[model samples]
Target: MNRELPVFIRSLPLVLAGWVFAPLIPAHATELPLLFSDGAVLQRDQPLPVWGWAKPGSQITVTFDGGTAKTHASSSGEWRVELPVHAAGGPYELSVAERGGETLRVRDVLVGDVWLASGQSNMEFPVAKAQNARAEIARAGDAGIRHFKVPRSWSDKPEPRLAGGYWRAASPGNAGDFSAVGYFFARELRTRDSRVPIGIVDSTWGGSAIEAWMSAGMLGADATVAAEKIRAKGAAAAQAATQTRARIAAWNTAPPSPEAWAAAALEESGWAGISVPAQWETQGYAGMDGVAWYRKSFELSAPETKGELTLGLGQIDDSDRVWVNGQPVGGMDASWNVPRVYRVPAAALRVGRNTIAVQVTDLGAGGGMAGSAEQLYLRAAGGPLRSLAGEWKFRTADVRLSSTQDDINQVDTALYNAMIRPLQPYALRGTIWYQGEANAYPGAAFRYRDLFASMIRGWRADWSAPQLPFLWVQLAGFHSGGDTAGESPWAVLRESQSAALALPATAQALAIDIGESNDIHPRNKQEVGRRLALAARAVAYGESLVHSGPVFRAATFDDTKARITFDLQHSALAVRGGGRAVHGFELSGADGHFHPAQALIDGGAVVVSSEAVVQPQALRYAWNDDPKQADLINRDGLPASPFRAERTRATLPQQTKQETR
Candidate 1:
């Protein structure tokens, strides 16, 4: 009816012709870079997606083996074409053609199983620094094992593709760069089955909060997430404004007189005496906050050689600004979790006795210098320097500040947008996670289990693989377990992790015994990997091997005695500490006050009884912040998972449903 309709409609044919004939333009005109290229395995029975970008409205065609498919680029310049499902075989070639007569060819594409390995720093930890890394490196020459590292990024909006990365085969030269957990998991998978090509995509960021990895829309959908996001944003903004104002005020203030500072450095001053490498709270400075200054003087050699100077100041809490001879050498902010190593230029060093000063700022919890009691040395260029960590002067300063809005926004979704979105669409066999350490605090981890499940479901939904295997390591025993029977956040989080197995095709690895009481990052990663491998064998490889230790099944009580049965695979119940009586059993009556109960392993069940809990209504095992006495192991040498049980009709499903509701 419109006058221009006929002319517009008439031009449609020409537009179609242009779109059809656009392939003669140039090579790479319609090609987009493939992500998760390393060790990528196509699902055997699924229509595999081979997607990328090209010129808008470009005619794109793909050819692989003896099959071909075609699709046109959309207005967004993105195009995707699905390859027919193939069997578990590879070493094939793929070619993509687009407008401008350009063709992009990829070689050595395989069909098999792929996996997405993700988590925190523990998962991001590279194999180069892992135990026996050299030995592992020697055996890295496996063409069957492939790896694709997702480049780090974050966005508040959900994205379809990631920024950068490609696939590479595992070799001694490249294995060092692979994620240790992913490499180990893939190694085990390959060892068990050599016919399939295994691809592992590493997409973990170090020291990232779980919220950062979640989609912005998902976070917005939940009221709790929304509230938490608001609170966190407000806190971050307030902190940032405070820090900015303080920095400006400090800059405006008169600079410290060099002579006065030098004289003060010489005098003992009123700096409180505190041991180096000791937490401030432990050193009688409890509840005391702000920046604390510490000083130490060391006599240097007469002739200071001009060379590289190494300054090792162990570690500082939150942030630190270090000075040597009144000159700022180096500083670190919000990096207290790791030791600081500073390479000071020789110009900062002096010949005679020099003063080394450090100002540490504590934001929360334990503050002050930390780490091994190794000597802090100052090395000269190509020469040895003096040890400076032994005995040094100390001082304290009070300064209150906070972070800025930009800082908060900078950290938001930075991990997810950069690390996760790019690895999407890559077919994977399963997933393995090792986190929850960052979310162990009280009240913070309550929703973590749901958040974790949501993340898993989100990934599965995104990948279109509903039945993909999902396995994770339960929180291990840590800290010192107190005698009192009370609610523990770590235990709750572990229970949450265990409950996540309720999702389809999921498994958990119990590592209660493999953890170190003194260290949160346990050194025995091999056991963790092997245990994860066991879970993979059962869930992913369809093996009938005993993959788990003992999981609590049911508990019944009669008068004063409670009979607790378990689902132990491959072995009978056994106490790990060589005692006839089992440990970590606590029975509680209607008062809800739990008391340590005597326990004994009979067959595959444990009988718990206590005079204090004659009418036992509930029982808990290994339920503490740091469970040191937990020795409930099975005959297979695997530790039992921590759990809390009640005699009431509340079952696992009901509990989960109630929690969700």
Candidate 2:
């Protein structure tokens, strides 16, 4: 046994002695598990459910708010009793008891609004490093804002209750660990309605696909998903088993031969030159996969230093193995999603010329060394270190096998089974989502809107919260170049998102202007949260905020100009930053060809005209991948949603009726 085992054994007699001296402890026929933990905020105006497992036939009594309710445990050891709905007031205690004498008491319980916040990585992203993190963290000291994070687990079947979770107040100490977007949204809600305590049940998983949050029954119910599941199960099992074997083989494989590697290492003067931080695949090594070695030599005047040394290698596509002077130092796996921070020990350094070598492996798209612009330095005991963010020597190893056949679809499928099903029974105020970047590839995103709406409707049906407030984030601008427009799948996906807003109580956050061209996951999550909160206030709380940008209401075309009208609240149309020329408007004629058109905001509407297209059949605004010049903003400063207008399809009968009219 470990050292603590003896101490625990030694304390048993003392514990018994104390128990004997104290008043006799009551014994119960059945023990019951605790329901919501201490400080839990039960939903107001609804019968609060207090449940646990107890012995069969044992009577369980729950007392709260001057009322008592009793229920008997079933033969299966499950027991549930609901406390009568209490008014929205609390700072009280709740007690649950069995006739035989077991009792559980929770103190400081509150009755208020409770909501479940769940999604993939973006929802799971914490507040520590998000945009305006410091200010937000400092402002999260409100006691009314509470959060509970459900521990991650995967289940083949739905669970009645989560394994473990508890409520915690938002404070600087704990706020850093809370979901940034969720926290901000809740903060906004709490600030708007200070009397109502807001409880956020955070259940999210990073890098999880949408399918994982769907139920197995739901998946089986859909023909497309059913076939996809059948294909996915076999592929998933094979991939898991293969990965297991690969990990084992990696552990068992002998270390690379240092002597052979040294012999293979390029001579100092004869090394090939390459730019640092550029993708090797894009830089004349297209289709190349697996480990490619890069080396750079720098001189150090001092023999030894005390401070830390940091190496900045922009970002690597997949995995990388790095070394300093042929000594294995540090590395990273997965992808360039996370920045690499290596701390060099003083002993690892030597005076004069030092060779820094890196072996990069690209498992998939956009692989190789990246992120070279950040701080990469060799710091001394009392001084700053030298920077290493420039050119480096390079060479390719053996060609890598392409594992593109491995199905990435299994992630969503598995997540649906594990995380989403358990929360089906729990009532929620609404759902806020921030995803779709993962499916933004060509031909893959055409059905995303349908899939997204189906998932929303499916969730509403399952949870019985029909017409529940469902808000989502539109894909922000990303990647270099403007080619991701004009038949771009992302544009199509955005259109789909716009179409979803036609559903009841649904809204979309326009985020094109706030996105970074270099990073798909933008750091400006504050705006993301504020926008989501605005939608929730408008749709869920029935607040009169301008929760949406200008949605395309309708348009009438003349010989030379198209007159467009939109729904605006509290203000008229205004360009971003008060610009004179409204941007991102295009006019297309019957030939399906489009050209830039001059646009002007004319009080709650936009007028578009162009000499290039004398008769405009359709007009599109902010319809490209990166519309940096898109100046269509509401007076409230929210950017107008991206959209493309085409004639709606009418059936022959409807067309005949229109002709008759």
Candidate 3:
């Protein structure tokens, strides 16, 4: 989104928590934070906080619409005043003035329902890469919808203000850079009620873990020591980041030419040998970031060269630019997880030797071409696929360590300190989250049950909105390999995410039916946004509609069968895809070994039974990493969330006389 900071902001001297100096204000000058600048959106129907820096003991006055507030600067030259609550309406001007000094005026300020959209890559995915993006971008000229993107930063302690950012109203040009999920969420809200302006505050980073977003205090016990270690590492990261930025800036001036690198005759004996379809981190280049070039050669038969050849490069981590036989075939700067399938024209193909070059840039976290080896191949006409799964010559063109290292944003409390803490207490109607993949490992996935709810409650406490609505996207399907009946980390994470629903005013949006098996970041975010909007309507707006599909209620066992009941709220149970028999049901006896079970729809319940099991003790639905056949949905077409239930002992009896009869 061209989030480059201004020279003044960039040159600010780094301090503890990377704080911008409050003592730098001129004696007669009153300077408000960047958040109070032009085009800012203040949360409506809440007490608005207007703050700034003035000379010590100086009287400050803030005026917006017909409301006025007065306060005196503290000994530290910091001052704040709260304006009266406002309704959802504005095009108003906000003025901050020193009692007898200069005044700063902000124009076109909006008062609306501001939603904090925070999470990882899926939430950070841009509209430019979403499905039907061209049409969506063309129609995104909504002045009523605005976005404020928080610049990526990290600190060990809370920072009082953002480094720099500005609000941009939705436009054809700007909307393409906006978070697709956030944009569509707001778009759906506008469809329901256009009376209030909608503002999306995007605070996100790709590949960030859940721990990175929480405050140290929120993590509980022994966190003091952990926070101390994180603080020390944060200092080291800042130093490393400074050096890395300088090197990157120097490299940007006159970086190595891609044409030379991609040239068919380019010398490559010095390049290192690396395996294809693997992240560079798994190779010898662990904890490395920045641009790298990969080159390989393949021999094509005469017939194979006649037709347009398709080159599949699996999926590059952050971005990639590809060239085949010294000609640019295709490239994309975003949607890192989407496979790169470039159509190689026959003209660019050769009967024999052909050189294919790919330049991959990893901005943060894991990098390089991932996905299965089968996905990396070449095909033409009716010919069998020629695998590109062997060794390839690789060379690092540039490197940045800040993003790949432990000292950066991945640490606990890092993002909370820099990105979220600064914006706290800024009234918001609610928050929407999309994360968990980073923490979805075997042992870590279970911890999310408590950690997630703690984070949610902590955020509510931070804002002093006890019943603030919180919604999150459940972990979607992706093939992370595990038996259907065995423990699946993704399924475990989904269960952990569902656990958060027990908290007050919370809802979950299911994406199990919409995720791609090969891609971690799915492109069908429109449906995700639609589901989240439905959740918002039910949780935030007091709507009585069925926002979710049938939730698992209880299970009862009768020697050979298990009857599963669901808490269907204003909806009837039905299997989607026009099939009568339900899928994704499993049964297990006292041995605790699960077997595939046939299921049938029985009015308000699903009866499951497996001939392989004599007595069912437990049952599970959609209990796989990728539940490809799970089709249970409400009449509203919303898919039911994954769940497991055990048979209540009291519901079963030892061969009763009636049963014997």
Task: Identify the leading candidate in terms of lDDT.
Answer: 3
Give the alpha carbon lDDT tens digit for every residue of 410-519 in model 2.
34444454445545455467788776655554554555666777788888897677877888888787652325334555665677677778689988887888987655
Q: For candidate 2, what is the total of clashing residue pairs?
A: 14
Per-candidate clash tally: 33, 14, 0
Minimal lDDT window, size 10, model 3: 1-10
Candidate 1 local Cα displacement, residue 360, angstroms: 10
Query: Per-residue lDDT for 540 in model 1?
Result: 83
List lDDT for all candidates, in order: 0.68, 0.65, 0.79
Candidate with better TM-score, 2 vs 3: 3
Best by TM-score: 3
Please give the lDDT score for candidate 2: 0.65
TM-scores, all models, native as reference: 0.70, 0.71, 0.83
Q: How accurate locally is residue 448 in candidate 2, as Cα lDDT from 0 to 100? A: 62
Model 3 residue 159 CA deviation in Å: 1.1
